[model samples]
Target: MIERFRAGVLAAALTLLLTGCSAVMVPVSPADSSGLGRETVRVGIAYDSAGRGDKSFNDAAAAGIDRAKQELLIEASEAKTQAETDEARAEALRGLAAGGSNPVIAVGFLYATAVGTVAEEFPGTLFAIIDDDSVTADNVVSLLFSEEQGSYLVGVAAALATRKDRVAFVGGVDVALIHKFEAGYVAGVHSVDPGIRVDVRYLTRPPDFGGFSAPAKGKAAAARLIAGGADVVYAAAGGSGSGVFQAVAAGRKAWAIGVDSDQYATADEAVRSRILTSMLKRVDNGVFQEIQAFVKGDRAGGKKRYDLKVDGVGYATSNQQLGPYQSGMEKARYRILSGAVRVPVS
Candidate 1:
């Protein structure tokens, strides 16, 4: 019987490897056995291609989970996709749900289809997806953000900081979601100076998400932009934004704006001086709120829109270089929150 059990365990481990579902379960604390009646909720996160140390989007989501573990005392499991295939994502989700995670969070909109399929398979489990709102399911909640609003504020900063009256926007992927960043940035720059030239570039088109993870491509794109007289460049690329910062640091009198998180705070000391500011998307807040809602027994799944009104999006003012431009960014922020400025998503 012991040999049979060992064989079964080996087979199960092989199955997990074969499916590429690398879910690592981490218990925050031992189960409450004192009869205090405190139940520890289990949470799962399926990260994007860049995973935890991307220092941007995925890291923001990880922050929320970390907060939950400390405050809510929840057990957590995290999985990253080995490949950018739909099947790999689905397998990761399946592995988490089957392992008894109550709420499995898919960290990116790219997981929309996978979440939809897996949520159906595990009807009792609650699932939350960030960025994409197309998945309508009883077990799934969509955490949407107004990225354009934040991008617009950073755009204002870029416009005010640029000495050459020429700015650029670098996108990781040519998708609708990223287009929102470009649209808001261009609008903000033009709002300050109507004739200011804006150079836009995308590292990769759809289905080729290498743009988000490829730092070399990001560096090349930003270097070209700086060489072409763009004094301030805004990077809406995920992990690739690091390359943009590096390029800006290497350039003479060039500045770069980051996206999703306060890149200046996490950036290397050499590049921090060059990062003018970052468009804060607040993915961490969104992730934490969803998990909190689930734990509170408010499991009704629907779309929750996070906008400037709720402080869900804004510009980071970590770098003291932004002190001179804070007034302009604040003015833009007031306009957006007051409904006076209708930031474009396209």
Candidate 2:
């Protein structure tokens, strides 16, 4: 079963000026006078399925850890998730923790069980998991994001940008987390026009992490939706999203929506124009901030959330083609933030 609750209130906006065809993140060093005795914190990252090259969730988390490495001067070790299993995940985390990785970070919800098991054994090691809050151990911290909120915003963009009143969603996996993205998207499209047609599909089921890695599957899924009259497609399918981008680019009048990072800046130039916008889930910020908090000795175990009101999630504006939908996007964002509209988390 899933749950729903309002996130804490905060105000901020993400503005990136894309000058050289890509967004370069400036390293954020720890502030002066924290008074921590150690000069550097050793971090061990147990990455989610498909590893750092997936160019989606895992990659976003990697960017943050990289920033920490450069700015905080931390010694970090990274390990990718192996076969989807409690034992495999736990062994990976235990290897990191046993190797003196103070803050062992697990990068996905799949590691929830592994993290709980390992954090219990290594009580002194601080553990962090992204997208999973089931663990309540005193030594663990769960960094969660309002993915639905950002998805809703981009859904609005899709609704406003579609030429054929038809949009589609391609999810990496058929799970609760991906369902959150699906549910909010349906609502957003309906909010724009209740009669608009929306198509939804998932690449793979749980225990088979192929959905996040198989770009060929994502491409085929998007192609099917496009053939079925979907002119706009949103992909929350990690590296598999690359396939969706490819499908949309090859189509006649179709557009693609990216997830996690800004595909407009990161995607290939040939397909870049086909990507109207992306639901910017700031995984990098969440990871970096949590690490900073832990460094300051504030590792209280609980859900540390990111949401729309705080700029934790948003839509990419790097593409000039999305300018036409800016006013409506801003209005929808205001509604969501002002409680006039509430995004469902499935």
Candidate 3:
């Protein structure tokens, strides 16, 4: 009955908003003024080869978890390999269920199936899965990213950085989420310079999403795109984006855009110098907020979409990555942030 109530309350709250964490927009309890420390909140991060130290996807999420650990007295651990990802997610859910940990966070959309299976088995356990809407259990809070909007910003930067009106999108896998990035990037370029061309290629077509972690695959894909007239290539592959940077550096005048984290800081010095900019997805902010809510006994649920409307998603710190962009690129960023320009997410 307690589990059912929690699920029902979550469902009722979700239709009112989307996403997990503070973006849920529901009310939050006051700080635990009970003069006692909040018990530990366990967060599970499963990185598929993009792994925790990739300086990008997994790294960004890990930073968020670390923030939560610092802000609140919580326990956190991550799983790097495919097998570990599966086992860790299951173990986290089961353990949290046995305890009363509300909204145990599952980082990365890659854990959709694992989260689904585990969340279902542990109905009483509240879960927040980042970057996926596929899990609809009332007990689950889906954290979907408006990657298109962020991708659009970087697309505009890439378009301006390109000396030859040619850019490319290098993706980890051709999944639906990644497809949105490709479409939005191409659209953003056309939005700026109608004749600008973008080459599209994925490190792995399908069945081998592992390409996201394979630097060699990223290098090959980026090289092919570079050879095909792309003077600027934005790599949406997690760790693979490094390979994209490597290939871009090798090109005559190619630039590479990093995804998930600020490549300017995360990429190797050689690759970092070639970086155009990055799409900053605030996974850390979301993770911190979710843990905060759960710690305070705020158990509300539903899908929460993070996008430009909220800081949940957007282009990264422009820094020097955007210094070379045409004056128009800066204007676009300003317009998007100020509501003068609305970047599409679909």
Candidates in order have lDDT scores of 0.89, 0.86, 0.73
Worst 10 residues of 2 by lDDT: 5-14
Off by over 4 Å in 1: 1-38
Selected candidate, larger lDDT, 2 vs 3? 2
On TM-score, the leading prediction is: 1
For candidate 3, the per-residue lDDT at 229 reads 84
lDDT per residue, candidate 3, 219-315, as tens digits? 9988988888889888888888888888989984888788887778866666667776788877777777777776766566678776776777666
Q: For candidate 3, give the lDDT of residue 215.
A: 87
Error of 2 at 90 (Å): 1.2
- Alpha-carbon runs more than 4 Å astray in model 3: 1-38, 84-102, 318-321, 324-327, 334-346
The deviation in Å at residue 124 for candidate 3 is: 2.4
Q: Per-residue alpha-carbon lDDT of model 2 for 197-249, expressed as tens digits?
A: 99999999977877988899999999999999999999999999999999999
TM-score of each: 0.89, 0.88, 0.81
Report the alpha-carbon TM-score of model 1 versus the true structure. Answer: 0.89
What's the candidate order when arranged by decreasing lDDT?
1, 2, 3
lDDT string for model 1 (234-291, tens) is 9999999999999999995999999999999999998999998999999999988888
* Root-mean-square deviation (CA) per prediction: 9.8, 12.1, 9.2
RMSD of 1: 9.8
